[model samples]
Target: MRREAVLKQSGCRHYRSQPTHGIGRYKHLLPPEPDPKKKDKLPRKEIKPSSDHEYGVLNLQVSGYNMILVEHYSQYVHNLCSRLSIKVQECYAKPTKTKEVMLMQEHSTKMFLDAMLTTHERVVQVTGLSSTMAPILMEVLMMNQPEGVQLLVKEHTEADYQVRFKGRPELENLVASMS
Candidate 1:
């Protein structure tokens, strides 16, 4: 009672302590960060990539059905290979009504498609694949798709490069005018 009277007379209020609610109260939960300082005066050793540490991409084409469905299916296949400890990278087509491979920009697009087959790379070498693992990859891809969705898979190779690079010659004039 006396404490209450003294508080009232002094115009001071008692507040109950709380753990935290908003960011302000919770700031102290983490240790205060160390202030930035100068770097250590020692040079670090560098490790080079050996043949065993290298990787390569498996070029595939997913088409003959809904573009959206095919892209998802391709991603599904790539993901399945990764889970099985198989090294795989993906190249997918965007949603287009006519099942055409639309080019966003040649320079960037080629890196994911046309260039994969041509480049003689240490980390991304190209390899020809037969039915050893292809059937399993396709079956896994189909299981993930809807019953109505149909997909076609084929190995993209140098044979298809000219066809894509040539593009729609007739539309060339129209495309150039827009740019």
Candidate 2:
């Protein structure tokens, strides 16, 4: 009785009737159709290297559980590049990452933190490296790599720069709107 009274006051005619099967019954609640004449935005293009070398810029990322070992190895790589006459653009330390290991107790429903491992990372940027010299550098670095240390070498792109920083979409939108 109260529902019908409220519905009648709100000017609803089909308060107790079954819903219709046709799409027109809910057309007012559906989103408006997009304009077919409007053109969609295209993705931004990435900058390409101009040189003929395999990679215009190479990043040697070294990471390890031991901070001292990771730092020393990165320094060694920088020195080795200088000895090989490769231009070392920059050497910088990346932020340290920590991971927690959790273990479940026997016959228990709770989990506890067993250990925490912290990893340190460093990157050595080398520019103007030739295809022939890259292999030699990799071979030497791998042979001398310390225990528990990981090394990765790849071409540096704009994505690498973006990954180093945190994303702030609101700030980006504000800047775009201001421009």
Candidate 3:
């Protein structure tokens, strides 16, 4: 006897036979369809801050023991900001810093130079950024940051700018006396 005829003759009202092939077998696992009435409601718009409100300047400093990685990461940041329409005021490299590692000789009080490490630094200056975009930009940059590269984001200040120059006590004294 056929399956349908046997099911009908058996008087099983609650047991419905489902298709045994393809997606029909998994119909029960699928999610229910959404209500058409709910689709008419529009999505709420996000409110943005006023244009006159200033978000100030930000400095992104990337440093690493490897010069190539540091430069490449800095360039990546610059390109990302440009794509996001954020203003990049300047991009520059700071003077490279070097440190000497010394090791103590075996059973002796004398020390010898073991290795030298040089740290390279690059800065990307951004201006006219919105408050809402700052965190998002930082998160994206940090997520893609390379290994051994340190990223620092801080407000730009006059003291930070002055740090790039060598301090001259005589010039400062002269300016102070004139004032």
Misplaced by over 4 Å in model 1 are 1-59, 94-132, 165-179
Residue-wise lDDT of candidate 3 within 7-53, one digit each (tens)?
A: 77866544346544344356458898888778564343222233555
Candidate 1 lDDT tens digits, 8-29? 8857443435434343555558
Q: What's the lDDT of the predicted structure labeled candidate 2?
A: 0.84
In candidate 3 the C-alpha lDDT for residue 66 amounts to: 96
Highest-scoring model, TM-score: 2
**TM-score between candidate 1 and the true structure:** 0.36
C-alpha RMSD for every candidate: 16.2, 19.4, 22.2
Candidate 3 TM-score, true structure as reference: 0.62
**Candidate 1 Cα deviation (angstroms), residue 38:** 40
Pairs of residues at least 3 apart in sequence or in different chains that clash in candidate 1: none
C-alpha TM-scores of all predictions? 0.36, 0.64, 0.62
> In terms of lDDT, which candidate is stronger, 1 or 3?
3
Query: Which is better, 2 or 3, measured by TM-score?
Result: 2
Residue pairs in candidate 2 whose N, alpha carbon or C atoms collide under 3 angstroms: none
What candidate 2 gets wrong by more than 4 Å, as runs, is 1-54, 166-179
